[model samples]
Target: MCKSRILLVEGRRTVGGGQIMSRRICDVLSTNYDIAVFLPDGESPLAELLQDYSLHRYPMLEYHSGKKGVSDVCRFIYNMWRTCRVLRRFIRKEDITVVYVQAPSLLPVVVCAVAGMDVQIFVHLHVVHVDRKVRLLLNVCLQQKCVKKIIGVSDFTLQQLSLKNRRKSVVLYNYIDDCIKKTVSSDTCEKPVISVIADVMRIKGHHVLFEALQSSALNVEVLIIGRIVEVDYYKELIDKKYSFQYTFTGYVNDVERYLEQTDLVIVPSVGFETFSLAMVESWGKGIPTIASDLGGMKELVENFLPQYAEILLFSPGNIEELKVKIETILNHDILYREVSEKVHEVAYNNFSKTSFRKKLLGII
Candidate 1:
């Protein structure tokens, strides 16, 4: 039997959690399927990451940030139509049997269905909060004949979809690659080093973490890694005075290296997150994480992996509670070590590449 030809569509040009997940999926599925990627026009950081696969570019597929005005809406519709036309041509040219779209974007699903090809369409939902217009678009896309499955990064995300679409929705957790697992460091610093690996956005709760750091009496080193998405917010954070020593490395390539050196990782997201890839990455490196007890972070820590609940979680936006948790992790050595080992065990058993591949292949 011949292998199926799969075309993965990513509508974004920037590097984000969704793009990263798509890259990993492409890397793994390429060995079993004929894989190609349809990305937005212009430079994409994911291109360097997915060097093994064939990349197809189409204009007007780049991500739209912030609120859209009347003109923006008109432009969006025009661009979407152009994108659909390009996608239709590519599907016919490549003879793709499966169309895997990263994130719950309506254009790709609708395009795949309208392309009039005998292909299975799989849409992955990574965020819970969708605009009203996007939600309506998704409903229309779900009704399409080609859309076969809707995969959510977490159960929280799946539940946000319309009830009619829930029947086809499945929860598929993100996985950490072998490179991250193999590079687990057994070393530790003299003072506790807390790291936050996320884009510098207000929703990520970097300001809240900074407040906690200021209030806490413990001596610690903070490493803020990732691109500065919000310039004013990041400026405000840097300008504010805090007792704890910290450094903001604006988007480093070697995330595993930072994870290896850190004593603990913190995910203080105030907004709804589909899944915290940083938490999983930390666990892969045998490091425990202190994440806000909200949305998917709460679901992962409190429900999915309850063993490390007590030490590895804090209420979202609670400065005092966050301070206490940081203090506990820094002051208590035995508890930290125990939680670190347990979380690492859970990550290896469940979130490893092998486990993810098995589950994904079963679904396919």
Candidate 2:
């Protein structure tokens, strides 16, 4: 049997929920396939995070400008031409079997702009929030007819795409390794700790969490474990004088450590995401999360996160209402402990590495 040459494409520096999902699947698939990855050209931590696995890597053009009324047609053409040079070279050298790319089309619609080729292409549609422009792009991808498959991280993401893309879509939930799964322990201490784990991007709603904490009547001590993705944004939040009772562990090695000590995982997102990997990770840990009512989260209620989902619902951006509910949750220890004990089994059974690998193999 010939080795399947797999080409994975991503468009970010730091790892988000969807990217992490893709990475984990790729890591497991790497056992048999000859793997390579094309990330956007920049200094991203994703490049380093992927280093542990044996895979070839490339960096494509970071910008994708077209009919959105771009200033330079020549520059766009030049980038596309440059991309063709690299992709063609990779195909020949690697004897590529399948190309797995991410959605909202990275490499700046190069695949769509150029004529279709013979290499089998699979697009991972992680876009849960579809505005007018995004809907347009996926339509273009569907029209191309070169795309072989579309993997939606959740059903919510599948519905956002056109009927054509939907026809080719499949749902493969994100997962964590056994190493991490074994470490998913609930906080057994008397004082429950609430922690938020995510990049400090404006879309992540860390600021909203601060507001939620300030307004809450519960005296819960909070610890945040994530990278300060933007220096300016981090500075802005610190400047807001709401920094009390919050410890920012800006980008650390192990997230499981924070999860080990954390009781309540707060997922306050102001924007949409295909699937929340951190939320799944928390579920894997048997630690309940309080997430926003918006985005794909509504459909992805699982493990500990799902158990707490009922009380965690609040109007998007409504901090005052969030505070009131949070206070109510914290005050009720009997309910908290009841849910906490149940998640331990759910987290391991549903999201362990065995299940993740089995699902991937079943699909492929």
Candidate 3:
């Protein structure tokens, strides 16, 4: 018997957790099904990962709420309509059996394209929609007949849906590579080195982390990984006054190389971060981590590892609280090792590629 055909649609062209998750999904599903991915025409690490698969690229305008003028609105609508037409034609021509929308922004267009077709649609949500209008629109689209499953990277992502729509939603955590080995031990560091593996965006809370470190007396180094997606935000961060030593490594392919040097990893997102693969990656390396007690970060601690919630979480945007947490971990070696060992144990057992593939296959 021939395997069924699945089409994965990714809206954003940027390299982020969502794109990385998409690559993981493709890696898992390709063995069982004939896969084709639709992505924007661009040079990115994500595109490179999917190079081995059947790929189709289009000029995709990413969804944003910052549009002001009438022309901007018109252009957005035109692009949406164009994308819908393209998707509709592709589905019919290729006889696709299932359509997986990787980003929530593409949900509206994907729903329209699959209308009146014998295709099952699955939406994979990565971030919580902060805009009420966008949330309402997504809730409506998710209720369509074609949409079979609403998969959230965390339970926090499904909170935006209507109670009725959420009944159809499932929480599937993102995957971490099992091949990641612990190279640098947490006890080996002399001067502490903290790393933040996220794009230099304001919402990612680079400024918040910097502010927390400003009042600290310890001599530590901070490494800001990933590319600068927001240039203005990068400029603002650079202009700020700080006390600690830091370096901005603009987009490195081998993140594991940098992770080898990191003593502690921080996910200081002040915005609607549904899930963070960086935290999982850090834990897989037996590195202690701290994250803002919001969205998926809070959910992961309270739901899975409730015993260590106090040491692992802090209030979002609370500079004093963050600084104290940093000091608490740095001052005590025993406490740091306990968290590191427990974190690595949990991360390794819970987030395996085998488990992720099983859950995803069961859903589809």
Two-way lDDT contest, 1 vs 3, winner: 3
Tens-place lDDT digits, model 3, residues 135-189 = 7788999998889999999988888889988889999999888535474444566
Candidate 2, 303: how far from true, in Å?
10
RMSD of each: 2.4, 3.6, 1.9
Which runs in model 2 stand beyond 4 Å of their true positions? 41-43, 54-79, 107-117, 129-131, 178-191, 302-308
Candidate 1 structure lDDT: 0.78
TM-scores vs. true structure, each candidate: 0.93, 0.85, 0.94
Give the alpha carbon lDDT tens digit for every residue of 113-185 in model 1: 4565688888888876456766676767775767788888899887767787888889989998843433322
Q: Cα deviation of 121 in candidate 2 (Å)?
A: 1.3
- Quote the lDDT for 336 in model 1: 67
Report clash pairs, candidate 3.
Answer: none
Candidate 2 lDDT, 1-364, residue by residue in tens = 8667777777666676666666776778787786777665655678677776544444454433223325344444555566656666766776766777763555344363334556667777777534466467566766566676677778877887777767777887666664243333233455558888887877778888788877655556678778786788888888876534678888875887777777778778888766777766776666666778876676666423565567756666778877776666566667665655555556666667777778666555
Highest TM-score: give the candidate number.
3
Name the regions of candidate 1 deviating beyond 4 angstroms: 61-68, 106-113, 179-188
lDDT per model, in order? Answer: 0.78, 0.67, 0.85
lDDT for model 3, please.
Answer: 0.85
Candidate scoring better on TM-score of 1 and 3: 3
Candidate 1 has its poorest 10 consecutive residues by lDDT at 178-187
Q: Identify the superior model by lDDT, candidate 2 or candidate 3.
A: 3
